[model samples]
Target: MQGLAQVPRLLLSYAGVQFEDYHYENPDHWFKEDKLHLGLDFPNLPYLVDGEYNITESGAIQRYIIDRWGPAELLGKDAKEKAKLESFLSIFTEIAGAAKGLFFNKEWETAKTAVIEKYRPKLEQLDKFVGENKFVLGYLTLADFVVAEDSHYIERLFPEDFKAFSFLGRIRAEFNDLPQIKKYYEQPKAFKGRFFPEYAAVTIEQ
Candidate 1:
């Protein structure tokens, strides 16, 4: 629901890894269906189902996949690095919480000021952390994927309004410009029934 699958898809593709992506419209009883299918008692998404195993949380899914299929080794070769990678992913799970509240929660519809207030500090901190890094870990890794996914979704939500968040704006540009990620975007294979909200008001900077 947070459009977070972008990171997993792009990471898997960039590393020449193969994975299945499932997409379908929200059923009439969305939460109810999720519980029966994925054991999702809470409303969340961008989950994965591998054969008989059903996984719902994004962090759990990412770590599980990385552990199963080794690539650039975003989880690190040592015990410490692996732990840090998981820690970074956890941080983003929190960061996206604010974005989700603003963009997805209907209860916060008229609370734009409150939403901005919540997001401003988070963005400032992220901007500082991502600075001067060619990619997370100084190479393409899960940490980069963590930030890339959100930047991608944010740009998609309001494609040209990222200037207010300059570092994030640059991150989004770099992500789309990456050759592998560009390829994934060109051939997303998005399921026909995927959600496509009507064009909202989007501002583009010249």
Candidate 2:
């Protein structure tokens, strides 16, 4: 599934790096058969095996790809800027955690209003943070890919909620319009894999 893997996938595509995009149809089977032999102390789904280096954790994988294949400007012009970018990226986990409650609620219709009310303020705050910038830091960076991918569930589940934040939509368009990224999305493989189908069903509803 794309899940956390999307961040690195998008970054790698944007960087024009040739890489394997493996998806697990049955994660339990894969874990039992393959994970134990991987030699990683902390084996996890969405892991990256590049050359002799095997990396786990989505964030670490994203940074490694960016450092190795992406432009230096993707990190930032200097240390302070990079730190600030990281701070913004860190907020994504909180946003995703909050949205997950809404996505997985068994009584979604009953819970939707309250969930939206609780998260709307935070979403507005993010809108302000994004402001008029083309990307999170006014340029394409790992932060853009990470934050955008994490927030994608929310955008699909609540289009009106995101429409209120015009900058968010613009950023999405900008990211999708990237030639390499555009090509990747056109592939059928991009849409394959299980990723919260119940949530997707809810999203597709009128």
Candidate 3:
């Protein structure tokens, strides 16, 4: 499964850059076998080996791609715009952090109410921030993709809860409509069972 890699993958796809997609079925074994040879200071899964430049860390890798091969708009048009986008990204990360337990916990049902209560305020804040915008920063940007990706599992896990946040649904629809994104979604990489083993067992409501 792509996991953090999906952000860079989507950005690359959006830029129409042809790149290799590698999946490791046994990451632990692979790490032990190739870590030293990979030439990374701190080798990690989902690292990009672009010629001599090996980049680790999802956020840095995504920014590197955007800086080198981007539509520019994705990074924002100016300092102020970039700051706004980054701020949104920060908050999106916060929301994802707050909600991680709900997705990964074996006893999610037992604490579902408490989890919703804690995160609903942030979700509503996001809903208000996103009202009728074409993208998170009024145009396509990394912020939009980050937020969408983070929210996707929750949207699937709790459709009724997410449906109450109409703006999020609209953003998802708009983002999916992009030609490149649509193509990517058509044949998404299988979710890595190691990270999301229960994902398959969870049914998505239509």
Q: Pick the candidate with the highest lDDT.
A: 3
Which portions of model 2 miss their true places by more than 4 Å? 186-194, 197-206
TM-score of 1: 0.68
Worst 10-residue stretch by lDDT in candidate 1? Answer: 197-206
For model 1, what is the error of residue 50's alpha carbon versus the real structure, in angstroms, after optimal superposition?
Answer: 3.0
- Error at 97, model 2, angstroms: 2.9
**lDDT (10s digit) by residue, model 1, range 1-206:** 22556556665677677678765466545556755656554446676666676566667767767766657377776787767666656665575555554454455446545755665676666556666666655555677667665654455443343456566656556666888777776774732222224332322121
Model 2, position 63: C-alpha lDDT score:
82
Residue-level error in angstroms, candidate 2, position 32: 1.1
Cα-based TM-score, every candidate:
0.68, 0.84, 0.85
lDDT of 3 by residue, 1-206 (tens): 54688788888888988888877777675767777687887788678888888889888888999988988889899999898788778777776665655666667677667867777887788778877787777788998778667667667656786799776667777787988898876765523223344463433332
- Which pairs of residues clash in candidate 3, taking residues 3 or more apart in a chain or in different chains? none
lDDT of each: 0.59, 0.73, 0.74
Runs of candidate 3 exceeding 4 Å displacement? 186-195, 198-206
What's the CA error at residue 35 for candidate 1, in Å?
A: 4.8
- Predicted structure 2: lDDT: 0.73
TM-score ranking, best first: 3, 2, 1
Question: Which residue pairs does candidate 1 place in steric collision?
Answer: none
Candidate 1 regions exceeding 4 Å error are: 26-45, 77-87, 105-110, 152-165, 188-206
lDDT of 2 at 181: 81
Kindly indicate the candidate among 1 and 2 with the higher lDDT: 2
